[model samples]
Target: TNLLGNAIKFTDRGSVRILLHLEHGGGAPLYRIDVIDSGIGIAADKLGSIFEAFVQADTSVTRRFGGTGLGLSISRRFARALGGDIVVSSVPGQGSTFAIGVACGPLDGVAMLNPGQVLEAETARLAATEQAHWQFPAGQRVLVVDDGPENRELIRLVLEECGVAVDQAENGKVGMDMALAGDHGIVLMDMQMPVMDGYMATRLLRSQGYARPILALTAHAMKGFEQQVAEAGCSGYLTKPVDIDRLLAAVADALGGRLASNADRAAATPQAAPVAAPTPIPTPALALAPAPALVPAPGPAPHAALPPLVSRLANRPRLHSSIRKFTSRLASQLDAMDTAWQAGDLAELAALAHWLKGAAGTVGYDAFTEPSAELEEHIAEADSAAITASLQALRGLQARIVEPESPADQLNDIKAST
Candidate 1:
């Protein structure tokens, strides 16, 4: 944690990453955890004593970066106590790498995570089990239309894991073209974007006689927005920062009849929420003799307690590579927003905000999501004060958007594309 914290604090540009690998030595298996940072690097001269208490590369680094410098000393002592050592390498201006080597427990018992874990977790939270409930049958596909790369990627990842193939389009015009050009179980459409928006796209698709379900994805949840989208010919409406379950449920519902035609798979429709119906209680007035002391019935075993909120993307192996790609581009995504905002391109800014709002939340960056949504809303409302405040909040999160490389990656620097 200390190493990661330091890396992020000094890395104003580029990235911070964690790398891990198994090292086979003379007797034991050693695990190496490397925290790499593209930050102001330490000089060769200071590398020797830099781990000492209250020490840094120089006074200037201390003043500029603001640290009391106890983190490394404490970390090293802990590492040494565990029969491991923390080490560092650096190029004065480019970056630095800090690695700690430690022994691990036996690996013979290690197993890949089970998919049942997802069911237990999801069922505990949503009170809905049966993983097969949302799993589409063979040859099933859904068309996902959104201008945001992250949004499209997230939906694609989640759907693909459920046996549903996906086709993607970036904006309404392209989405409209694709919708007409192909056959799909359903179309998930983002209601706002450049070069055209979802409402127009759906309208055009409908006018042209394309009749498959088109589910509207929008951030706007105002009083009459549902009716507005319905009038646009959307089969269903879902608000943004799209909940994984809701998206799955809506798509499954849209694919209802289609599921029946494919491979003997049942079309699973979610039951109406139980809250919608009131359970009646019989008056106890006539219950004499304490209801005859009835014994409790043995029902199903209790489910595991609901775990911490996990992203819909979590628990799937397919998500790893996509997250790496998203993380690598995070800096430039922020850059795009700044440029759009400076140019007073409200449409462009709103599109960017819309993407950030959905993508960040989808990717487990909860803090980044709400502000992104606020910025989008303010831009739409043309409220200068709210927009500026939201922009500032988003700018603060930019510093925190540093990508922590997955422990499974070898800690390679993800070079930003030129």
Candidate 2:
């Protein structure tokens, strides 16, 4: 809060103390934090209007302590919004203490940490941030083997930013051949893919004396899965909802050369096409093109907002830009899924579901992944009734989303070329 900052600014020598107190009342617990400081104290008259907007102790104090006087006002508003208030006590020429009390609804299931632990956690986070800037080898190629076009595209777009060339394989069969033929630094192999999954491809490659690192990608994080990955001859494994930093870290671990912090791709070879910044398409809504069969809307409509699939990409701007393309592709996949369902092709249905399971989460349609995976499970079980039910459930999930009014716009032209 501003009180702490203000205290720090005014106090030149003595220590500033933050004392925390808690009380249990009729309702939720109330937390009161007192920021005490040994500094030039406020006059008794000024204490009355100190909480007022743009008002500080005095001109001399302002000359000594520089701040906009906005942080306190905003923080006061927030405190009141939570059914609390901030009060201050000071003696002229002595010191000042400001206390804020607020009701915290619940502490259930929260992991509490002390100041030392928090500082340690912050230190680790900074190290990860610096490591993210640590460069991979320039012009090093990484092979991405997966059936989902969107998944492959997501991996390619991220790696290319770090000066890596990416080659795609729709299935493990092709991945094996590419691994043998190309000079790739590492392989990111998706486990549940069509035409020879990652396990078989890795086994085949290792059998043929291909010594490069093969990292398995899977949605399954069940207990004891790492043993299976080791048995499959993978160097390690990564899970779904493809995280950008985790992907980079995995590649770093495999290559054993995480050096440098600032460098661009070598201009000698062009990187993969950069995804355009998200802009409105001509069509208002991006999903459910050639709309599939669906049941009635849900019991309650979801509030209009960015889906979790897309929202998580807010930090990775380049990768985030591909959202429009992912939604456009989603419509086509829905149509294909419907067609496959009409013909009762379980293998095709499961494959489409599997792809959707990975693709939906990658592009911010995370809620869609559950339904897609459910449909895939039913198909794998070879239960026609469950498959039909699960298919309807998937269709219903798209139907429930409330549309945002003209969310993207005039930027459509910028989006189209990509």
Candidate 3:
């Protein structure tokens, strides 16, 4: 499917075809699939390198056709793992065909459903799951504080589906005001925002004697952030693309109901200590090594590696939809950051980078975190040239944000490989 998708994406005005057949070789059966595309084909010299991770035919290809250059690498890995191999044939200007051959045992007693039937059944199952309603305590209000409009909406949609009432604030100041004005059962506070930040807001809330359970919502899942959240007097913490089940579990636990296990909750909660001057939370970008310079002539695009999305939420279509929406918004956010940089508004630029850093991890765009963090540092140093380079690198990273495949698709690929 990935190969076919890429084929179509690269093809300007040509048909793509898929052919599947069976063959007998050495007393065993083999399944052969061919994906043929009348698209911009690979150069003979670059053909072998294309299957390597981060290696595209050219840098221009990445700008023209967006991809992380990971699909073919992953596909090849899957093929090899399944006792098969993927071979490609291409012409510079004509087209390309990818042949995937996997070894299969004799099918004498096997029952096989048509691929279309299996796909339809799986789609139906997913649809049914999406339609199945979940129930939560009525009027159980939660406060969500984040600068991203799309993120706020995504969280609201997920929580509202579970029958929770949600109030949102665009920044820490508004969050602080709303928290004081309303009776929220719990507060989901983002660690980085303008006008104020989660750390300051949390400290103020604690100092002022408002004692509702506050869960730190952060983009940085690196070491020490949990400690930072704890030090700030938050009750708990959650990392982004917040999983639905985990979010509900956290909420329920915060509200003194145990819908989900509390094993991890202790880590999120503050460890009791005598009050002292707060330890400054280190910026997440500082944790990442600087990315290598972007080579205009691409062999492999500079790899900005990120951890995979949490598996529990990866299977859900709603999460995927949310991710797509978040990534779409990322482009505009980058643009805004550029504008802020051009205007010499370091505060605005820092705030945008901080928000972008936090939000990127939730949607499996961890690669963005480092560049964003670097942007923040550049703004702090008042280095205009560094800011320009970092912003440009961020735009490049944005193109490489790879969406993970569904679990079902993974299983199917595994089965095909074997």
Candidate 4:
């Protein structure tokens, strides 16, 4: 799929072809699939490196064609996992072809059924079963505490459609107050915030005998972050750019009193067993509501103004309502960052950079990810000049983000060209 998809993506003027056939060797069947594209072909020297993770043919290729450069690497791994391998051949100005070969073993009882059909059926069954575990009981309410208004609004919109009442707080202090005063069935707490961080807030709530389930919401999907949240007394953790299905499912599991222990939460990965759902409670008066259509807001004017939010959710009305507030908050953070740098306050600068990096990506300012990362490295090395230079570059990128096209549009254009 990856090879074919890539072929289609790069071949703007010509055709992409797929050829599949079976061959026999040593009295055993072998299947071969070839994807060929008349696209901007790979340079001979770069062909091998393209299959390596995060190594595109060239930096210019990556800039012109957006990808993390991991698709082919992962696809090769998958082919190898299936007891096969993928090989590539290309010419600099002509085209490229990828071939995959897999062993075809004898089928036993299920010989009558097509393998693809059987796989699809089993996948659908598992999806249905997983979704069933995310159905919540009646009258459940969830609290979302995040400094970013857009983040909170997005969560609220998703949960409300799932028949869950959502209340918001701008920071952990307000969140702590609400958690103590209100009877929330579960809490989605942001780990990083201006007033009292989520870790401290969670600790306070735990110490004050607030027993409801708490799930940490964070953009830092690093090694120790989940364990940190678990140690702070959270039931589970969800990383941002939050997936709507996963968010609702986590809440449902928490509301159903199926929270995982700290140890389990710390070690858990996506492939781990899902939390068990409790017996269904009586159905409440509320019913599932259809989500509204997303329409993009007016683009921001050019120049020193903060860039408009450019996420997958940019067109969502609920998220649009919080855009100004989100941008304003980001602007203030940048100003504070400047102050911290001038004052040689490395600690403050690092903290602000960390917060800005997380919040910027959450609100869809993906251009900031790299510069923010660079700023963090500069701060760690105590390189003031490099930090200043990176900050200026970030501001320039933010200012130039006027009316940038959404990734969805780019994808559609690629499909049309193919």
C-alpha RMSD values across all candidates: 21.8, 21.6, 17.4, 14.7
Residue 31 lDDT in candidate 2: 72
Worst 10 residues of 1 by lDDT: 284-293
Better model by TM-score: candidate 1 vs candidate 2: 2
Clashes, model 4: 0
TM-score each candidate. 0.52, 0.55, 0.49, 0.54
**Would you list the C-alpha lDDT of every candidate in the order shown?**
0.70, 0.70, 0.72, 0.70
lDDT score, residue 319, model 3? 66
> Model 1: runs farther than 4 Å from truth?
1-133, 257-315, 377-389, 401-418
Model 1 Cα displacement at 287 (Å)?
Answer: 40
**Residue range 94-182, candidate 1, lDDT tens digits:** 67888887766555534323346545545454432323346566788899999878789889988886778899999999999888888
Off by over 4 Å in 4: 1-39, 52-56, 59-82, 93-106, 111-138, 257-418
Candidate 2 has an lDDT of: 0.70
Candidate 1 lDDT score relative to the true structure: 0.70
TM-score comparison, 2 vs 3, better candidate:
2
Clashes of each: 0, 3, 4, 0
Superposed Cα deviation of residue 68, candidate 2 (Å):
56
